[model samples]
Structures are given as C-alpha cells and as structure tokens.
Target: MTPDTATPSLPPTPPSRRAEFRFDGDAREYFRIWIVNLFLSVVTLGIYSAWAKVRKKRYFAGNTWVAGANFDYHGNPVSILKGRAIAVATFIVYSVVDNFFPKVGYALLLALVFAAPWLVVRTLQFNAANTSHRNVRFHFHGRYPEALAAIAPLIVWPLIGIAVGWNMSSLPASGTEFFILSMPFIAFAAVYPRVVGALKLFHVRHAAFGEARFALDLPMGDFYRIYIAAAVGAFGLLIVGMVPIALMASLSPLPGLMVAWQAVYLGVAAVFLAYTRSHVANLVFNQARMQGGVRFVSTLTTSRLAKIYFGNLLAIAVSFGLLVPWAVIRTARYRASCLALESDGEMDGVLAGVSENVGAAGDEMGELFDVDVSL
Candidate 1:
C-alpha cells in the first residue's frame, strides 16, 4: 500500500454524546392518522377507535427518536378493546343503578372513590410495563398505598379543608370580607401544585428503564417553593393581565364585563396550569437520575410552554378538535426538544436486561382512569 498518512476526509465521531430527545413527527403525517382515525371511528360507530389509538401511539412513539433511535409500542388493540368494553359496561351499570336504584348507585359512587387508589396502581403498572425504549421495557413498582398517597391532596383533603375553612370564616358583611373569606378557596387551589409534584415524584421514582431505576432527590422545601411560587405568580399575573380586559369592559356599553370576567377566569386557570406544568417538568427532569451514570435535563420555560399550550388549544377548538393529532404532535415535539439524557456511555449499554411481557389489563385500566403519569 502507498504511504498515505493524510488525515481522513471525515472527522471522527465524538467519544461521548448526550442523548438529546428529538421528535421527527410532523402534523402532516399525524393528520393522516387523525383523519383516518376519525373516519373509521365514526363509520364503525367507534369500534375502530381501539385500533386507531394503537396506530396513533405507535406513530408518535416510533417517530420520537432519541440519540438516533426510536421507541416502540407493543400494545395489542384487541386487549385495549376488551378494556374499553369493560369500562363501558361499568359506566352503563353505574348509570342503570343511578336510575333504578338510587341508594345503591350512591353507594357505588362512594365505593368508586375508595377504589381510586387501586385504579391508579393498575393504570401505572400497565402503562409503565408496556412502554419500551431500545428493546428494554420499563416497569412501575408503585403499590396501592403509594398510589393513594400520590393523589391525596386533590381527592381526599379538599372536602375536609372546605368544611374547616367554612367553620373558620365568620359571616361576611362586605365585598372585602367576602374576598377574605374566599382565602380558603385560594388555599385549596394552592394545594394543586403540591399534589401534582408529589404524584410526579412518586411516578418518576418508581419508573425503571429496564433495570436502571430513576431517582428523584429534591428537597421537600424546594418542592413547596416551586408550587407556592407558581400559585402566587399565576394569580398575581392574572390580576395584572385583567387590566386590558377591564379597559375593554369599561370602555363601551357592549356588555363585555361578563365576557371579560370569563376570560379572566380562563386566563387565571391557564396561568396556574402553565406555571405548574413548567415547574413540574423542571423539577422532575433536572433532579432525576438512573441507576447508572445517566441523568436528565429539561429547559422548557413557562412562557414558551404557555404559548404552545394555548396555541394548541386554540387550534383544536377552531378545528372542532379534529386537529387533536396536530396538537399532540406539537406538544411531543416541543417537550422532546426541551429534554436531554446524559449518560456515562451509550444509552442502551446501561440496560440490565429485557423485561418480561405484561398483559394490557392495567394499560386499559390506566386509559380508563385517564392517568397521565407518563414520563
């Protein structure tokens, strides 16, 4: 061979690289899926929805590439159908009981409340167990007690707090007193962040990518600070944001004050939702770690998130929610852009072993309960 010692034309790859999340899914591609889903769902009287869901999830998961690899969904639509059938049956039973046997229906409703924890656990177990990355499955090890505790703030304590707040507040004689009396309701709203944070922490801690488990170790004080700041900031900013609406309401005899007030309420709700979402992502992503040297980083800001969130909502509303696929894709792409995975080595090299196949019962149950504990 000739003595050719010149450097190669192409540069060598970096020794190590952080696994950045990049979603390749586009609204156009998902719109096809969405349109088909809608057509089949309507034509088949919603029987094809099970398969539609599978297709949609598969498309999203398949397109969300991280470090040049994508995820896969192995859920069977038949199983999903079975679960949906059960859910429909349950709902029908509840309705029938409520119509024909009011007392039994009331008892059933109360029983469902107690059953919420079990429902949560089943859904978590189903969802985490089915989702896989690089051929390694994830698992959720959360028990019923843990599941119940995760959502206690929202479901269990609100009623108690309401009664306590009412008893503590004296009868109001003026608007100022009414506002003061409403402080307890404001406090109730404040509990949302804590509940959201706790649920996220619990879910993240229990999630395992193969055998590499995740750990979240932020201080409790920091958790409170995030939520309190968001709650205060949300309401405070809402008050300030209402200035323009107030101007409009006062400017004309257009009967705009009621509309302005409604906008204010929605704006306040959005602010709280946006702030809570932002803090939650920051807290979970910035503090989490896998069993190996793998860690997470997220930089999705509240302002950016709020813009995207509202835009998606508006798009869906304008399109009569036929654009839901686009909305989903938009969210996935933006959120993916905000996430990065830092590992000691190659992403898949950290996997301990393959997880065994699990049934779809829990997955369907999770779907039934509308549990959004996805990572």
Candidate 2:
C-alpha cells in the first residue's frame, strides 16, 4: 500500500476539567447582615421579611462560585412583599373560616391539596428565573399538569386512606377492617420512592441554565435502595442509641431521663437524616448531566453531614440560636465543597437563554404552607 493510503491516527481527546463549587460566605459577615435583617423584620412586624429574604439570597448567591463565576439573585422585593401579603391574607381567611365553619374549612383544605401542585410549579419557576450564573439565567419550565402527575400518587393515596378510615369507623370493626382501612396508606408508603423519583426527574429535566437544558436519568431503584438502607440503619442506630437512655431512665431522675431521651432522639434523627440527605444528594447530582458536555459530581459523606447537623443542633441549643449564622455558613460551605461541575473544555461556549418575569406569590405561599418542592 502507498504511504498516502495508510490510515491516519485519531486526535487525542481533551482532558476533562472539574470545577468544584465554592462558598466564600463569612460567618461574621453574614451574622451582621442577619442581625440587621432580624431587627428590621421585627420592627416592621414581619413586613420587611420580603426584603430580608432577597438580601439573604443575594448574599448567598454572590458568595457561591464555580468555574471562576459567581451566582446572582435577581429577586424583586416588591414582588416578594406582594406574595407575602397574599399568603398572609390567605392564612387569615383560612383561620377565620376554620374557626367559624368546620365543614367549609375541610373544603378549603381539599382545595389547597389540589392546588399544591400548581403552587409548587410556580415556586420552582420563580426561584429559577431569579437565579443567574455568568450572566446566564436559570429557568424552570415545569407545568401544573406535569407537577400534579409527578406527585399524584403521593397525594391521592393519602386522601384515599383518610376517606376509607373515616367511613370505616362507623361500621363494626373486624380483623380485616383495619387492613382494609390501612391499605391505601401502605400503598402510599410503598410508592413513596417512585413518587420521589418521578418528582426529581420532573424537576431536573425541566430546568435549564441559560439555553442549555439539564438532564437526569436516575433510576427508581436508586431511591428505593437509599431509603430502605437508611431506614434499616436508622432502626439499628435507634436501638443502640436508646440503650443509654433506657439505662438512664432506670437509674436517673425525671429531668435526667428527659435529657437522655432527648439526646438519643436527636442523635438518631441526625444520623438518619444526614445519611438520607447525603446519599440522595450524591446520587442525584452525580447522575445529573447538562447540555454542552457538562456533568456534575457530588461527594457528600454521611459522617461529615451528620457531624455538622448534630453539632449545629447542639450549638443552637447552647447559644440560644446565636450560632445560627455560623451553622448556615458551615453547612453551605460543606455542601458547596462536595459538588463540582465537570466539562470537556467547553465551559466558555455555553450561551445565555431568555427568561421571563415570574411572580413570587407561589414561593411565599409555599413557605407559609410548609410545602418544600424545591430541587
């Protein structure tokens, strides 16, 4: 064969660059801001909380850096205030009606349950729209229908269980009657992992950083495995933790017994919560991918997270919450340290996407209702 006819070798692949997330927030600096925010909110009778929220988010976002770029928050204080006002009004109405008309209150509760999915969608959209990195805004395109579909199992089964139990109580109780009443709840528990997986998938896939879409192909089995393992580990830890409590109860006075019980409870809770949080976060982030050859990595450890969480609890208890800012900083720093963005030398090539204005009413209402649907 002629020399020109010989096959040429392929070019070598570019090295993958890893940019770890960094939080440069100073505890002392944040404490000053936090104190001012607290004082102002109290003085204003909580009306200033909207401004406080924006300031806090901006501070955190500005401090969070990755790949030589820091994040920015562009939330409007007026919008947030409007949202808070609406939330307050809704709460007042609910309280007043619930006090005067029990049946109407139940009906309103049902309405809220159905409206939850829409509120979650709006909350996600509003938060994403307000956050930016390197001048490129993030966006969430999830819709109410999608949100409802993703979480239907979680909502429906519990409602079914309640309805069943309510109606069954009027009938004569039999051996299988309890099981019949409990079936919906058991089903709900069994499907919880799948529902969570679905929600995460919906959240990640619908999100975008600029025009580049985020991706996640996490398996349902991963959620189940993590939760099951955490449950078993928690049970084991609870047994071990309770041994000292049991002994103290047998020998110690009432006050000491209460203290021992509380300690054991907090310890078990901290360990399990940390385990689930770390493992799930690592799994979700490590599996997440984005357009432009970008991917994610998370190295969160159960032991480290548990230490921070448990220590935060102890510190708050001892300092009467003066160390809240410090605890927040520590947790943010650790979480940032554990996460990274991996790219194949294309970080500078990604372009910004267009974003629209989103209202903050859903966000404030979600907070007031204790509905945390954030990703």
Give one digit per residue, the lDDT tens place, for model 2 in 72-184.
99999999999999989998998888789755775676687788888888889999999999999999999999998988877877577556745674777688787887788
lDDT of 1 by residue, 1-375 (tens): 899999879966546558789999988888898899989999998789889988988898898888778888877788778877877777789889978976577667666656667777666766666677878787888788987787776664445444444455455566676665566577656576566677777888887888888898765566678777876887687778777777776777466677667666666676666777777787788889888678888998887777777777668778998888888888888889999988766666766556555556555656665656654
Residue 189, model 1: Cα distance from true site in angstroms? 3.6
TM-score against native, each model: 0.81, 0.92
Model 2 earns a TM-score of 0.92
**Model 2 residue 336 distance off true place after TM-score fit, in angstroms:** 0.2
| Top-scoring candidate (TM-score) | 2
In model 1, where do residues sit more than 4 Å from their true spots? 1-16, 99-103, 153-191, 247-251, 255-268
- lDDT for each of the candidates? 0.75, 0.88
lDDT of 2: 0.88
